[model samples]
Target: MEDALRRQQTERLVDHLERMGPGRVWRPVVDRDGTVLAEGGGPLPDNLEEYISGVDFAGKSVVDLGSNLGFYSFLAARRGARRVLGLDIDADAVLGARMLAALHGMGGVDFEVCDFLKTPPSIKADMVLAIDFIGRAVVAKGRLDQVLATVARLARREIVLTMRAVYPLEGLPPLEPGLRERYAKHISDGKFHAARYAAHALGHAWKGRTIHEGRVDGYVLKSVLVFSSNVAETWEEQGGSS
Candidate 1:
């Protein structure tokens, strides 16, 4: 009986680790039940709480792109969103998010493993979060216009976007000379052109607020942009979801 029990316990632990991880979670600052946790190791997550200080999520629905561990998805649900859907490409991360939501009893929150580039979600929402996703895709895929259009379509009310503010490896490790030169051109082009390309895509439709931390000479920091449709403009005029 003892030997059988040990095997069962080991099987259960193996299953759990297969779903969660040793250090793979993007945001583990919250407990399994959504409570905040203080941690050591890496830097704290940049959820952009201050950006949302004035905008209320009550009764709105949110779709989060690249919702690694559902951190922002949980935030939306807790802030009174009627529903929140977190989409990621990683199957294990989506499974982890779903399992954690079950533990937290967060029926308003859901997660799916999806490749938005191929098959975009048919379900649109009041808000779309493309944080740390759009600029990278634009830079890497060279499909700036198409990607931005999809983002606009996903959002019925508002869009919250964030991008890395710096990209210059003037003093980094030695990459192969050709690879390094190509990467340097890519970085230089992306840094100069992504923002302008974004404006051409859909920035003209909505007025926005820009949020940036001052430049760090050698580090990348998060920069945010929040914009709304004509209907969502009420969020600014009324200080909450319209």
Candidate 2:
């Protein structure tokens, strides 16, 4: 009964964030029961459970950069990671994630308010996650290279990076005629060179990858690049030199 009452209080905090705090959650925060505590107006998060499940999180430490609402961090903890840390610059995002963690009694994960781009934190983990929006966002703002370097440095064994605009590499969903025309040009003949882009930006070639074509704001798609840190470092030394 005490735990139930505590959850009720934490639920109220999440509701407050929705009503007057962060305004629009960039992504949905779903609990163990699959209930979305805070709704996201943006596109749904891609199929990440499969990705996270593939990682052997036993005895591993994981870091999630641009963690948003910390869904992945909680998921990592669920997957048996020894330690999980989520970092985001947004205070409300951090607060919402913390409340959700406490609400669900998920004490394995931690969230901190930190701007990875402006000030890289002195934390390291066995695996690093820069999922969904951070890749394209930093790219758009001319900060992808720096952010990617930090992501690589933060990882000791593996890195999972997902970029949004890699949509052009695959088939796009049909939009209205007007919207279609705009994105048709944006896709650039459907050849975005995602692998080459990742090699240059992150300075490492991906060992495996998957793509999810979900449109956003009328047009946009998603792609993910999963890298083994050991292989990436070796490749950087031998052949990735530009």
TM-score, each model? 0.67, 0.72
User: CA lDDT of each candidate?
Assistant: 0.61, 0.64
Candidate 2 vs. true structure, TM-score? 0.72
Task: Assess candidate 2 and give its lDDT.
Answer: 0.64
Cα lDDT tens digits for candidate 1, 1-242: 95675455444434654556545565435444334442322333343454344456789989999887677788788789999999999887787677666655688898999988677889889988876565443545444445567778898887877654444344323343354443443355333333433444575576554444423333344556566766434323433211
- Most lDDT-accurate candidate: 2
Residue pairs with backbone atoms closer than 3 Å in model 1 (clashes): none
Candidate 2 residue lDDT tens string, 70-125: 87787788878889999998877788788877877887799999988788989889
lDDT of 1: 0.61
138, model 1: CA deviation in Å? 4.6
